[model samples]
Target: MKEGIFFGEGMKFVKDDYPDIYDAVVGLNKAAYTGKVLDYKTQKLIAIGIVAATGDETATEKQMRSGMNELKITKEEIVDALRVVLLTSGMPAFTKAMKVVSKL
Candidate 1:
């Protein structure tokens, strides 16, 4: 397996066993990250919020750490983003996100 940024276990498995699909998915990820308006950090933060709102604890934690370590995103900044989740996604989602943030 190749070493790269943020390839989940499933992606790793796909890359190893199904190179064609992995290439397509990797291409899609690259395209998604190349948006003209939002910067990479903002996109990552949004991804974190989406994952958090879904109550996917593992994905939330992984994305949180990736944003912090790779993008140098501050905890305060993440909390600020979570505020949007609170308003739109409601208390449960926001609270779950908060708990994930607290761990980091």
Candidate 2:
């Protein structure tokens, strides 16, 4: 509850209007917490990479910035991940993703 944030309104919408998706998100949280393949920071970085590779701009931008802030992931690391994505997902797919990363 800060003076001008919309967190409460957004949470209310998720709880009231998107209850089913909200419930699934809770379940997904449990599954995610159970997994331990990578460290939390690494996992977040991988998630950023996947989002970028899939061309999800909103998610990519969010994760890219969050990773840099919370996980201390450097821009160079993100750039390397994008390079791998380029090889696997094709340059055409990665082209837009790289653009998004570069803006970061």
Worst lDDT run of 10 residues, candidate 1, spans: 1-10
Top candidate, metric lDDT: 1
**lDDT at position 96, candidate 1:** 89
Number of clashing residue pairs in every model? 0, 0
By summed lDDT, which 10 consecutive residues of candidate 2 come out lowest? 1-10
After superposition, candidate 1 runs with Cα above 4 Å error: 1-4
**lDDT scores of the candidates, listed in order:** 0.84, 0.70
**Per-residue error (Å), model 2, residue 61:** 0.9
Per-residue lDDT tens digits of candidate 2, residues 1-104?
11111223465678679988767666765566444776666776677777777877776777778778776888888888888888888886578777877898
